[model samples]
Target: MTSPHVAALRSVALNVPDPDLAAEFYTEVWNLAVADRQDGAVYLRGTGPAHHLLALHPGEQTEIRNVTFRARSADALPVLAERTVGAGGRVLRPVAPVTEPGGGVALIIADQDGRIFRFVHGDAEHDVDTAAVPDRPVRLAHVVLNSHDVSRSQAFFERALGFTLSDRTRMMAFLRCGSDHHCVAFGDSDRDSLNHIAFLMPDLESVMRGGGRMKDAGYPVGWGPGRHGPGNNAFNYFVGPFGVVIEYTAEVLQVDDSYPTGGPEDWTWPPGRIDQWGIGQPPTPAIKEAQQAIRFMPAAAF
Candidate 1:
């Protein structure tokens, strides 16, 4: 009966100052091809099969130190690491499997904002010939965070990553881990690192052909071809390549368990609820004038 959320996001490690220009801007805006590189780390994957989803290294300073996921085997990862230390969350770091020709069983974890999530168990023998680049990349749905206390980081990923809550406001919150409405999301306003990382496109012309290939690779589009209102998906936000805050969503909003949970959609702030999925479009006034020329120095102001 081992199953306390079997990990599911295998790789997302970035420390890039310039790991080959963040692997050539994630292989020219999300084609994600390179799957290996040594010591100075660089491994990306997405054309299919998942041996990696993105990892680059070249740190000097610049945060978002970690975020990984994947847990469907190895006997349910120590019962999901004892439900992430019984929900108070603290497993700092651990490592073991390094095997490669497939068969999966990798691990890495950290939460409560040291933020890193990696876990693999099986499947990823390597694929994606793409016939000649017809198009591929169908999973790894969402990963967003910018929490000082977005309701205790959305109640710690809905209590250690089973993640089911679907909508909210007071800054923002939209969670879902296994069914594709959203894999992760959190925003308590006051920003910094880890704010975007989503992938799930099959419609809206593949989110306007991946936002017109990240606007013809000039790269700079933080926030939406627009449509939100909580996981109604159809979103877009960019400024990736090492610092990451990228997304390219599609139709989101799915629920079960009768669809209700928590009060005020669970924390007030619901107005038109960020457009409630009517192709809202907002956020790119040059991404709010580059987040109003950043000055938010909190975390005890360093």
Candidate 2:
């Protein structure tokens, strides 16, 4: 039987020490607009149709609240919930109406390692901005999570979330639920943390322009401006405020069920090269530290 799946990665919620400051950086420097403000939280949107690509909430420390995805259909929710439990994950909240910025029926689940994921169906969408904006991101491309056990995490995503493995590199495993090469990826790490969040720029020009803009804003590119082998995407990464690693990427590979899944052997780079195009510098010490610093908030705390 074909497993139920999510249609796309919708948004990510983050707990930041100062939501307003984070909101300012995202709006002024990153090009995302404020979509909504509720209590002390802020919802930000990209040029895409998704209601909001990011939500920032006030917290004592910065941490990932949850990564959200859009379910293919309402029927998929209960089935996914069942599969989640079967895969050793817990249903943090049963399928119910979401009261947050994007109103939808959501099923919140926590993987065995305590990483939270929310699957929503019937969420509101904004009118898509079709005009080409040079440095603006259209939507979330993918989220990379650090996993202590790559195999176990991969199994849960496959069995419970119906995500297919797109590729497995030496340090990471990319998984997809839809056409985009990967909606989520797992970076092998000693602890479970958020590796980074990637935003989809309109094109290669936008990726470079955005990187320049970030540099102008005093945030240097921590790594990239290079094409990745597995996804074939051009990227520029930065360590944003509160040690949150963010990326601007474009030209992500799109694939169907017929696409072949490659192993680590297929993704090796030459000596002194980190990506397909070796023009970019390696990730800085700060970037490396930040990538593993933002842990997910305990499921019970949210």
For this target, which candidate reaches the highest lDDT against the unseen true structure? 2
- Please report, as a residue range, the 10-residue window in candidate 2 with the lowest summed lDDT: 1-10
lDDT of 1: 0.61
Tell me the spans in candidate 2 whose CA falls farther than 4 Å from its real position.
1-3
**Candidate 2 lDDT (Cα, 0 to 1):** 0.93
Kindly report which residue stretches of model 1 are placed more than 4 angstroms away from their true locations once superposed.
Answer: 1-46, 51-83, 86-102, 106-118, 121-125, 132-136, 143-168, 174-183, 186-199, 202-204, 208-226, 229-273, 276-302
Clashes in each model (backbone N, CA, C under 3 Å)?
Answer: 20, 0
Tell me each candidate's TM-score.
0.31, 0.98
Residue lDDT tens for model 1, 166-257:
66766767666555555776766654446666776656677777777887888756665777655566777776653456677777666555
Q: Give a tens-digit lDDT track for model 2, residues 1-302.
A: 12357889999999999999999999999999999999899999999899999999999999999999999999999999999999999999999999988899999999999999999999899898877477898999999999999989999999899889999988898999888999899999999999999999989999999999999999999998899999999999999989999999999998987898999899887889989999998899999999999999998886
